[model samples]
Target: VEPYAALVLGPALLLALLGPRWWDRLLARRGKEHWDSYEALAADYLEALQGMPTLRATGAVGRVRERLERRSAALHRTTVAKLRVSLVDTGLTDLAVQGGTAAAVLVACSSAATGRTAATGTYLLLLLASECFRPVRDLSREWHAGYLGVSAADGITGLRTAEAAVPDRGTVAADWASAPEIRFEDVRFTHPGSGRPALDGVSFTAAAGRTTAVVGPSGAGKSTLLSLLLRQRDPDRGSLTVAGTATAAYTLASLRRGIAVVSQDTYLFHATIAENLRIARPAATDEQLRAAARTAGIDQEIARLPDGYATLVGERGATLSGGQRQRLALARALLADAPVLILDEATSAVDERGQARIVRELAAAGRGRTCVVVAHRLDAVRHADHIVVLDAGRVAATGDHTTLLAGGGVYASLVAAGRTAQEERAA
Candidate 1:
């Protein structure tokens, strides 16, 4: 009915048709760059900060700083590009709205000049034209302001829809009456994109209330085997059982609650010594902390610190020696007082004398509990009640120190190599 109003509607309809497509393509394209660069920068920052001590010790801070600078530059470039796209799209949207308004005025002016409409009607048409453009203009401004929300929506949706790789299915937690035995039956796992399986049909039993030590060559999947037991990744082929119950049947929280792990690279955040120890057993008494630390053979060293138990160990315990850090981790695990404890080269950095003492301590402290240990240093495993020797992701030998030493197989060779290395270091 109002033909002149159609003039104001044309550019808006055209913008409505084309603007969204442009934003989707240009905004998303630049947004992805922003995301990628941000991820890269975050990874670089984490690596640099965590390895800061090593970089400084090796005099490679400048090298790491250069890499960080490059990552930052890439992120900056992505940010500037994204800003430019937003600005251009916003300017184009404003131009379309203005163009539609100007067209409406021109059409109304023609109607009045040709003596087809009164001044009052022409004024009314112009006012309606501006009002019509108001909604479209407000939409453009809001789009520019809220584009971040649109860009982040995909990431949010993906997280909400994501499925766990290994679903947690149990409603009831596994209840063990005693220190549970750990058993892996025909277990196998291949890391994604790797043809070689990390663990192949690996089977072993960490008997209840006994120490079971896993020893292996460098690439024998010792760590991979431990990862499976911790449920860091579940087996692709077989079952892991605790106390004769399949791990898959137990709630992850319950299963993990029953086991404690201390690895060579055990982490300790920047916190007080007692604070770190308390992480394992928050309700642990001070005496309990001291007893555990003493059993780990680190109590003397800790006592010597200026602040004693209140001392703040720097990032990853950088303030302490490697052996001290390992001992501290051992104390934390002991504090957890779980049914099972794992030491994956946990005491490798300690002096052999201290290692021997800690081993004996674990043997004593482990009296009603089970301990699983993985150590390249045979001293830590030599006295273990049961030892599983791994080679190429399979058990090559299984026995105690005497039987395995008598076998004169891979286990024997490892012992010989270790003795030679010790001799070399001594000489």
Candidate 2:
């Protein structure tokens, strides 16, 4: 056989070397887009599911279902296209492997017929030719398996990239045993793509072992202020400190561990009551859970349930009443035992008596910890040790209830409006 017959394997060797580069150009770009498309579709499905009740109320469920079907069909088409691209690459690889082996076999036969080698030599040549393509086949198989990971890795990176831009790292630890003063010094923040700053020149201190209430008009930046304190956001122009130490000095995990939050929208998964409470403190005992629930004014209600702590909350606590969900959130926060507690409209859904009990519980807890509140009702904050009134993203006034009421500014007007509303309701 001619030594030049070995030249037949040239194409296969070239493909083995260059195929990866080709795949990277086509497959990687498609992979990222594929993940993004799937994510968008999934988000739409979740939205549709969550709003199903509203859709039914408006007699729009069928229309929404039709839209979803259209999207599903589009997704099916996209999936088929991606599969075809993968198959094409695989087919090319198989073609090279087969063509090279066949050429080598034909040459070996020609050499044997010419008696250029004994039978043993021809058999050896055939065996050697088959094994030569094995490595390329192995690489092709590995590539097919690994392309799935490439697409999945993009989705994982996207989920994490939001907070990755700002690396919050520190070695300083928070003191869990003592309540720390949380002070915002001329803090300012503008949300991405927003035309106006959410909080501008806003400064206040939530003193240790005291209840501090933030009362504001609609859009007065109350929630944004608390988010800064929670270190969910970093202020653009100023510093926030806890216990005289800048919040950035403490590790993110430790800073968060020292604080607990109960937002207006309570989130409970589909699980037993006991399981949800344990999420706040995984090691909490049954007695501890009961105590926190009692303080949040929900223990008696649980006692009435047939399964008590074993009751399921359903999806996002949909099975329970709004008041019940809020109380459960409060109980979970209390169970966390953090030295600093943040409550945003914590009592808005509770009955009058339940609200009073929650207020009293906060007061009692204030002796050993700090409480920062974004109060829904102005009158509910009458007993707050300190009140910070915000207007137009700035501190309009700051004082205790009586002083601010007597001072006759924004806080006083808010109080008056609340009282007048109450009087109107009574009349």
Candidate 3:
């Protein structure tokens, strides 16, 4: 009877040992295919949705819709493939369990009929055979259930480890009280995953307590230089010094504390205007907030709002006009009172009238700090104490606005192009 029981359990044991491996392989392949297909479909769907306004304007909505449908069909096919694999796995599992049980019962009954075993022994043999396959079934079921979660966990772990590797060395203080000058000597920087250098051997000086304007064509690396100054990135081969010390000597916190920046893409929290301003100077008084707003040329606009300074700024300040958002960003920066002020195309979004007012306020408020202005509009920087023109990642010329115009070089060409565009817009 025991030998008959062993014969019944032998094949079941073999199936249990190998079934999980086969099942997991099928599940893993299907899961990966489904994940990839779903991700592609989702990305395509989001892009189509975001471009719907333009598609409608151009009468291409049908074309976009067709593209989306194709993506959806592909995703559906992958999902169906996954379901088929699961069904096949389930069928295999049932076959192995039922076949092993019937074979065991047949062998045991034959042994009992020949007087080799009694009915009690036959029942015990059947129970033992079932128990042998139980663990294998549980393992196969659990593996399928957790495979997707395992894949997701691996991705998250890699991301966290990569982010943790960037060093944070902001333990030393940077000199900001004296309004130190910034000097870049032969600075070069290449962005990650890019073939070309963003800034190549760029050398210039931003004098202390005076406004310096940087002008260039679209890819002349004006923004790259500002990023280096803020220590957002380190140069590849050259040195960036604040005052007389290398920027690396200062902690990131101390370095950023000395600089205030307002750029074209302004970000505002979903809070009251006063709350946004207080982010720059957390303990500022109401009078201080109003004063900063006045300096930024937005005080009157804020005062006119129904809630005044207490009005909520919708997500990313979307509720406000472009000019108002720009002014609010400036007011927040002003409240910081950093020794270095950076205005990177700060008025690029405002109308001519608002641009003029903001430029005037910028010039007035930048009296004592080291100001760096990167602008395409020549008029905004005409009165700068110094202007540096960059061409193809190198400093092409450096002088006051008038001096560069008189030189008849890259700066002159840029000024001419700017004037032509302005005239065209006016006409």
lDDT of each: 0.86, 0.85, 0.85
Error of 3 at 309 (Å): 3.9
**TM-score against truth, every candidate:** 0.83, 0.87, 0.81
Clashing pairs in 3: 170-251
* For model 1, the run of ten residues with the poorest summed lDDT: 16-25
Query: Which regions of candidate 3 deviate over 4 angstroms?
Result: 1-18, 94-142, 163-171, 191-196, 270-272
Residue by residue across 342-395, what tens digits does model 2's lDDT show?
Answer: 889998998777788788876786577898989869756889999999998999
For model 2, what is the error of residue 322's alpha carbon versus the real structure, in angstroms, after optimal superposition? 2.5
Given candidate 2, what's the lDDT at residue 349?
92
Error of 3 at 316 (Å): 3.2
List candidate 1 segments past 4 Å from native: 1-21, 49-80, 99-142, 149-163
The prediction achieving the highest TM-score against the true structure is: 2
Ranking by TM-score: 2, 1, 3
Check candidate 1 and list the clashing pairs: none
Q: For each candidate, how many residue pairs have backbone atoms clashing (under 3 Å)?
A: 0, 0, 1
Runs in model 2 lying further than 4 Å from the true structure: 1-7, 10-13, 16-23, 60-63, 66-70, 120-124, 158-169, 416-427
